[model samples]
Target chain A: MKVLVPIKRAVDYNVRVRVKNDGSGVELNGVKMSVNPFDEIANEEALRLKEKGVVTEVVVATIGVAKAEDQLRSELARGADRAIHVVADQDIQPLQAARILKKLVEDEGIDLVLMGKQAIDDDANQTGQMLATLLGWPQATFASKVEIEGQTARVDREIDAGIETLEVDLPAVITADLRLNEPRFIKLPDIMKAKRKPLDKRELGDFDIDVPTLEVTETRPPSGREPGRMVKDVDELIATLKDKGLV
Target chain B: MSKILIVAETLSGELHPTTAKAVACAQAIGGDIHVAVFGSGDQGPAQAAAEIEGVTEVLYVQHDENNAARAATLAPQVVALAAEGYSHLLAANTTTGKDLMPRVAALLGVPQVTDIMAVHGPRDFDRPIYAGNAITRVQAPGDFVLVGTVRTASFGAAGGGNSAAVSDKAVDAELPSHTRLVEQKTGGGDRPDLQTASRVVSGGRALGSSENFDIIFKLADALGAGAGASRAAVDAGYVPNDMQVGQTGKIIAPDLYIACGISGAIQHLAGIKDAGTIVAINNDENAPIFEIADLGLVGDLFEVVPQLTEKLG
Candidate 1:
């Protein structure tokens, strides 16, 4: 079976994001960009499936500007066999992204699509579910474990209450959550080899889809909490709690 | 005036607290708010939803195949109801809401805004990005319906003095059958839920082992607070993932949060930033958690926790 993994270029998870002074969006000048952490986990899962001999090919796709190709190359160095880059100059919403991915799934005849549950930048957590709905396919979101048997895949998901397991047929969508697996580091030799891999480029207008329907009016830093004071000992701690009526 | 439809969330035939919080967000938008409750032979949640102060009407939809927890079956029903002249759709930013609302937005051919912290107007909202590091103000197009999920931690629950009418609404959409809930394994405990708990005490990897977590639980029990764990502790098998508090885990905003032995990674800080009062107790004074802590104690958790519990008792 062919496995398709959708990755995105986002701000490095460790960077403390600051809003632009103009209130347009987060400042991206000279900021370090990398594959979204959750999407990295998804790619790692797909590579593991390939190693287990369950998947015939692993293809990674991204929808962004030319800078996104750098992210695709990094995934290729990590283990993806090929890359598909859909060029978009402006930011696209989850609905448009899902529609574009749906077209790719049909065009590539993909049997499985693995992706992140949410991107750290937008935090929308919508693409996987939206694509599943548009395709009328089964979805196993926030998957912690996945096991394949014949045509059915058994997935364990991390939910608020506890773990819930579901069985979905082939041609399904699975969104990876944390704890799925720790992504492996790319070695220098692998990076050199990745430069020789195949990379395909497509345009956003190639697919017939509606434009994004949301607009950003402004952005600013969240209000900060007051600086806290230090207490001398346990006695002082109790006093502070009592003083605030928090005890 | 804009008409808003809220999808009510329920657990075990009872309305979840976030449902009322979603109502509070809708009320802020100044609209004729209606709530839709989908379940199987359970009118209790619908009745509970009607009692929320700002809710004008409650539409209870029942069917044999309707399981409110399953997004595949519920999204279609929500889409059908949204077509009846409702200009805005909202739900709590809980697991159910995060899973269901996006599908509704996709079916309606609109973009969804998730984790909305502030509603400035009918088409304007503020949502957190990069795990609450920044807030972005967004506006939806007036020509299309606006769909979003309210951040329950930021909004207080609507008051309960008013009574609204409840009506039965029929399901006309073709629900998807590709997904089904085989079994759910919920955590068995009598402790307060971490997400809505008024007070919480969380432990980190410094607790050593799963056996050492008892001290953390003991202190929480003494204070009648919920017990939480950092992602470091959960990944180390010191606790279950469900108890983890961080960007990938549950986001909580309790009245008081006590961090025991936690080094306070940025992701963990993101989860508790909304907390009213934060207290940090770690062996290392240089731990990042001290920066934001309202009260900092530079001591070993193993020694401080027992003494604190004794003092509280």
Candidate 2:
């Protein structure tokens, strides 16, 4: 089966996201950018499925600007067959981005769509499910384990309470949770091989999707938290919680 | 006529906190409310949702395959059914709600406010941005409607003992999943979910040792609180990644959150901003965790946590 993996490029998670001193928006001038952490899991899952030969062809796709090719090449180096680029900026809302992908999925003839549960930037875990709905396919989100049994798949789903067992047919969208797998780093040999891999770039408008007309009217730094004061000792802390009836 | 449609979720026939919270948010609109429920068998999940006050009727989606909601499948059906009546839609801001509700939003061609803590005006609502760091009261574009995923921790569980009549509705949702799951390595540790717990005991980098985190765990266990860690604490190898609570981590809003040896960074505060009552424990008097903390304890966590645990026990 052909697997379509969607990845995102966001601010490097390790960096402390700070608002610009001018109060415009996030300070992104010199900030590091990496593939969304969860997307790495999606990439890793695709590679693992390739190892089992269950997923015949694996391709990583992203809906972002031309610079996202940097992120896409890394996925190819990590071990994807090729890459599909839906050129746009990363700031578009989740549904708008999903709409661009909905138009692109038609030509791909994909059997399954795999991606992270949510992009770290927006923290909106909607795109995969939204894409599935647009395509009238099934979705197994927050999947911990995925196995194919003939035409059906048995899935172990991670819920807030714990995990539950589930099943569904082919042509589904699955979002990778944090515990899915640790993504492998690309070696020098693979990096050289990735340069040779076919990287296809498609304009968002070519698929009959309008570039969403939206803008960040105003963006500012998040509110500040006051510094905590050192008390005399532990006794005073309990005394305070007790007084507030919180303890 | 416009109304609010709800899908009250349940597990193992037990009422989930999110169900009541969703119902409560729906009732705040002071209009007709319709709830749809699905489960293995019986009206246990349905009955639990119907018990929430002001529930007009509970629609039981009695398809055998409707045991768990396949949102991709149900989104179209809900749009068709709900379009016949309601203008607005509502669900709890939960893992399931986050996963499934937006599918319906996408189908309806509306932006979903996935985690609204409160609602005001006719369709406008209030939601937190940057992980509850800033609350924005937004007026939706039009009758396009607002899908409010209520924050479960922020709203108290509805309890009016009001159970309405149960009616069955057939839903032949043809949703089937292609990706198959093999296994799950659940966090089988003895700890409550950070969202559901009333009290949370968090550790920071000052803990020094992951093994030394036993004190935080012990304190949490004694108080029936959830155990959490600052990003610094998790980075310093003092706790598991699941225990990390911050903007980039998990958004947690407990009734009482105790920060031990933690100097709260802005991102960390973003995660716990909605906590009803915050208590910061640290040696530094000017720790950032204290700004939002209702109660601040300046002391050595090593000396303080044991005493608090004993008091809790």
For model 2, the TM-score of its B chain against the native B chain is: 0.85
* lDDT digits (tens) for residues A1-247 of candidate 2: 8888889988887676765666446666788999998898988988898899888999889988788899999999999999999887545667777787776677888888889988766566788887877787778888777777677666766665556566777777888876677789789899889989999998766754442222333345445545444456566766766777777
lDDT of 2 by residue, B8-100 (tens): 776545656677778777767668888888655777878777778878888887655455455554565676656556767787776668777
Instruction: Please provide TM-scores, in order, for all candidate models, with all chains considered together.
Output: 0.97, 0.82
Best by DockQ: 1
- Candidate 1 lDDT, tens digit per residue, A184-238? 9999999999999999999988987775577887889989889987777888898
Q: Which ten residues in a row have the lowest lDDT in candidate 2 chain B?
A: B176-185
Instruction: Report the C-alpha lDDT of model 1 over B29-145, residue by residue, as the tens digit.
Output: 998999999878879899999999999999999988865368888888999898899989999998788888988888887889899899888889999988988888888866688
Candidate 2 stretches greater than 4 Å from native? A18-30, A89-91, A148-152, A188-193, A210-220, B27-30, B68-77, B107-110, B118-139, B154-194, B202-218, B221-250, B260-269, B280-303
Regions more than 4 Å wrong, model 1: none
CAPRI rating of model 1: medium
